[model samples]
Target: MYVLIVGAGQVGKMIASNLEDSHDVAVVDRDSETAEDLTYEYDVLSVEGDGTELETLREAGLEKADLVVASTDSDETNIVVCGTAKTASDAFTIARVRRRTLLNTWEGTQGAFGVDFMVCTDLLVAQTIFRISGFPRAQDVETFAGGLVRMAEFEIGPQSPLVGERVEDVDEYDSMTFAGVFRGDEMIVARGDTVFCADDRIVVIGSPTSVKEFAMANVPETTSSAEDVVVVGGSEIGYQAAREFEAHGFEPRLIERDHDRARELAEALPKTFVMESDATDTEFLDREHIDEADIVIAALESDEKNLLVSLLARRVGVDRTVAIIENTEYTDLFETVGVDVAINPREETAEEIVRFTRTNQTEKIAMLEHDRAEVIEVELGPDSALTGRRIADSAADLPDCVVIGAISRRGDLVTPRGTTVLEAGDHVVLFVDAAVLDEVSTVL
Candidate 1:
């Protein structure tokens, strides 16, 4: 497929990087240096011009493009780019925005801005934070097969009970599969003899019940529920996160230094406690007993402030700390320095936008460990390579890095095993190394 990406920013560059390996990609940016940099960085056509202009779109070969993505930092510019692209071509248009209001408006009126699909960065980050908050020690979480199958990534803390247990011995959960493990920079495919270690990010996929049971077992001391949640900052992402918790029946507390913004948030969020105070103030933190909270989320606009808040929360005895990181490079550093999880809004937005580039056979996608691997849900067609073969036999013909995580047949969860046979119409979720993603897609 030929893809034309507008705005060559972080999200656009990521989307280009993910697709340039499989499709024909062209990027349009107003900055000559950025366009030149992208041209030399990846095997893509880089056009220097305004994306919303018709002449620029023509120069970028939009006439023959299969997809057009508008991913500028400005929400209005992205919307206009998509709308403008629609006037000249029939390519599938995707716009990335930071405002929930724009997404709601586009949803209420489908294709309102000539955008075939829209992704809200703040909203996606908020939802991701909310999902991670549900399971203790989970670095990332995603659901597949209509919530029947779940995939979770948990970091083994220094004191975790499964520190030295072998994968085979930890197979107590009948329906769960040990998909893979991320140890430092190495991606180890899980096996019977694979032993758990401290700080290892283990990815598991299975029935929801099994996943939940595994989470509870992994952290026996931490309660399964996140009751007392605290959000620092009044940014859109922070406010949306507090709203998400409130919608789920948790009256979270939000701290914003700006009195006007705090009042606005308090008015908008009925169940959330919005306090006007500096989150760094130790006296205020102690007076409110913030140390007793189950989780403290640092969503301030500044990366340094979020890091400071996360470290302070940890110092104050909060069970977990989730920080919003604006810089992609700071993700690993923040986690290494003590933040439980560091989420990049642009990364989340890029992942969501790239999901649309998958083949029609793919139903959903979840990128893990910063695109090192991917867990994808695919429906087997009548002509699929594995439709009539047992998984054990099919394994010989498939890539070594791929693992059949779970299967949903007739709305029932089916745990994958070597003896299990795959049939047409089965929704199979598989964990695959990103390096072989294209090859795996071709076969299944």
Candidate 2:
């Protein structure tokens, strides 16, 4: 496969890095230095030009490009780039846009602007954060097979009930599977004797109810519902979170520093209490009783401001805080400084793009333990390798690091035992070591 990506920003560069290892990749950016840096870092071909221009795209060899991703910061430029690429080549085109209006218009019109797919960064990040809100300690959560199967990852806290319990003694839920365990640099395929330690990141796949049961059994307090929630900033992310919370029957209180934006948000979200106050000021938070909330969400546009507000919320005695981080490099630092989780929009966007690049029957992909392992959901067809076969026999012949976590059939969730048989039309969710992803793909 050959891929040509426009914009050498973090999202574009990350996509190029992921694709260059297995497919031919070329990146075009107006910034010569950024394009050059990607060329050296990822060993991908780089073209310095305006991708929105027909002549510039032609110079980048778009006619032979199998896929073109328009990821420039400007939505207009990205739309034009995709339209031009479609006009010049038969390649699939994807546009990365932050504006919700463009997404709605393009999606409803069915490639009216020539984009095969559109990704809204803010909306995706907002939706992701909403799904994992108060989901115990899950740093990341993804659902597959019509919400019947769930994949969750989290850092083991010192107070967790299962801290010293072996996997066998953890009282396995009927529908849950312990997928993978990570301790620093090692990735361990979770087994009966495997012991969970403090700070060890664990990934699990199971039915939603079973996953919730596991969380309640292990990390009870953080998973508590019906708590006060306070969200900072009136940006797109903040407003989206407010709306999502409202849909979930939560009348969250939102604090916006800008008076005009606060009024607009108040009108937009009828259930949420929109307040006009300086989120950075400790006095404002104390006066408003913001620290009394169970969770504080920092969605300010600036990474620095988000970090500051999260710190202030913690200082004021908020137990858990989730912050939107624009800078990917500040993730670990933010966590170390007491922020519960830092959401990286660019990284999330890149993961979505890379997942869409897969050529097999894979429907969804979730990166676990910082990409050391991955959980992929694939549909079994009549001709596929595992269809109508017992898992015990098939799993024995499969790669060592691969494990079948669950199977979804006609909306029913099944935690596959050795005797379980995989049938056609079943969606099989498998956890595989990142090193063996390609090998597993070939067999599937």
Candidate 3:
């Protein structure tokens, strides 16, 4: 596929980097330095010019491109670039917009402007934080179809009553199903006899009500309330997180290196305690009693700094440590270094745009990962041939590229075994590698 990306900022660079390995990619930026940097670092063609200009876009071969992504920091620039691309070419266009206030209006107005999709960064980040804060016990929550269904991840603790319980013996709670269990490094397809234990990360899928019931039933009763949250860094994202935490009845403390920014944050959030000091400094963190924090979030702009501070918080016995990482390349490394959660605002925003772009098609993607993998939840079409077939009978016909994790039918979620049957109207969640998306689509 030929793809043209308008912007050389962090978000544009990430999208280019992710797609460059498999697609013909070109990046456009008004700043020559940024364009040169992208060209030097990746295998993408870089064009230095105004992407919204028809002449510049034509020179970049936008007419022949399969996809055009407008990711500049300015929402106006992105909108204009995408509109121009859609007018000049038959390409799929995606535009990135930062303000949440513009999102509802844009969704209704973009079609007239020739925009294929609109991505709102502020809303995406806010939604991610909101979902995570709502379910403090889950390490991650990926919603599908406007929150109609969700996939939540939780780590089993030693005190969890569900530990060591077989799948079959566990009572179904609010129509939820265990999707898959990540035992150490391997992701296992859950079975009836599979037993959950401490340290195992389990993925469960269901409606919001059922998921909450499942968490209430399986998680330890000793789970602490979200009373104290320490946010390290006073960047925009950090400030937003602090505001959100405060809104949710949490006493938040915002730590920053710059004295001016710290004072400003303190003034803006009178309920939150603000400390002026380097977040990476152990002495400062210790003085602030970091160990007493229920959740410690390292929201520094730099990924390395965030990772280091999060690791230190972990070593000092913080209950949960989350790091805000700008660069998606460092995501795996942050996870390896024991960061409980790594949030990438740019990547998250891009994902929302991609999901919005695909809403018109039958490819109902639920969650997208930065690593080129997608988890899709699609209802079995009534005319589909696989309906009413048993899992054992349909094994050979099912696409080898897709893995069915769970099935929901008649308000009951079932962890399908070999004998489990698939009925029409059943919503099946499948984790698919990007390489075989077409094959999976054909099979479905």
Candidate 4:
């Protein structure tokens, strides 16, 4: 597959990096250095020009490409790029925009913007935060098979009871699989001989009940219903999050400093309590009894401000805190310094664009171990390599790192065992370590 990506910024570069090895990737950017950097470092072609222009797309071989992804920082520019590409090629069109208003503009209009799918940055981040909020102890949570199954990542606490136990000795349930463990920078596909240790970040795949049970056994968490949520900042991200919470039937209080903006937001969002008070003011928070809140979200404009408020919230007594992080470098600091989750909009946008460009056959794709591995959901086609084979026989030829998490056939979820035989039209979820993506691709 030939993938032509517009804009070589952080999000564009990440998508190119993921697709470069498996497909033909070409990047377009106005900056010569940034475009040249991708070509020099990765197996991709680079065109140093504006992607919204006609000649620029031609220079990047847009007409011959299988997919065109527009992920520039500007939403208008991205829309124009995708529309332009649609005129010149028959490629699948995906546009990354920061504003939902821009996306709604083209809805029900055929080829109006030439964007087949639109990935809204704020909405994706909000949805991710909302999902993780349900399992406060997990660092990351993604659902597959219609929310009946889930894959969650957790960092084993120092005082966890399972710290010294071997994988083989632990009681196994019919509903769960210990998928992989990240010991420092190394990834280990959990086997019988594997031993649980403190500080080992592990990925688990199971039903929601099983995952919650497993998380409870491995991590220390406060026993809170987390019904009350406090949101800081009147930024666009904050507004979007509040809207998402309301859609999910959760009423969260939003704090804004500016009086006029607060008043406008209060009128606009009747479901949320929009307060006109400084979040930095400890007095206002204490008076509002914010420390007793179930969850706190710091969505300020600046990274420093978000960190400052999150730290303050934690100091006061919020058990779970999520910070909106723009700079990727601040991600590790936020986690180490005690923020429960740091939402990076660029990464969220990049992951989806890469996954879509990689394949059109798979039902869904999710990155794990910081993109070192992928969990793919696909329906077994009639010609699929694994359609007629038994699970054990298919496992023998596949990479050792592969783990079949779940199989859905006839609306029933089956935890795959050795003798399980996959038939055509079966929906299967599997975790494939990055080392064998090509092999996994061919099998499915």
What lDDT does the true structure give each of the candidates?
0.93, 0.85, 0.74, 0.85
Candidate 1 lDDT by residue in tens digits, 1-444: 999999888999999999999999999999999999997899999999999998999999999999999999999999999899999999999999999999999999977999999999999999999988887778899989998998999887778888999999888888999999999999988988999998889999998778889988885465777899999999999999999999889999999999899999999999998999999998899999999999999999999999999998888889999999989999989988999899999999999989889999999999999899999999999999999899999998779999899999999999999999999999999999999999998899
**Better model by TM-score: candidate 1 vs candidate 3:** 1
Tens digit of per-residue lDDT, candidate 2, span 50-93:
99888888877788888899987888998999999987799989
Question: Would you estimate the TM-scores of all the predictions?
Answer: 0.98, 0.96, 0.74, 0.96
- The alpha-carbon lDDT assigned to residue 46 of candidate 4 equals 87
Candidate 4, 276-324: lDDT as tens digits: 9989889988999999887898988999999999999998888889999
Misplaced by over 4 Å in model 4 are: 222-225
Q: What TM-score, to 2 decimals, does candidate 3 have?
A: 0.74
The lDDT, on a scale of 0 to 1, for candidate 3 is 0.74
The candidate that achieves the highest lDDT relative to the unseen native structure: 1
**Cα lDDT over the full model 4:** 0.85
**What TM-score would you give candidate 1 relative to the actual structure?**
0.98
Show model 2 residue runs off by greater than 4 Å: none
lDDT of 2: 0.85
Deviation (Å) of 103 in candidate 4: 2.2
Query: Which window of 10 residues has the lowest lDDT sum in candidate 4?
Result: 217-226
Q: Locate the minimum summed-lDDT window of 10 residues in model 2.
A: 218-227
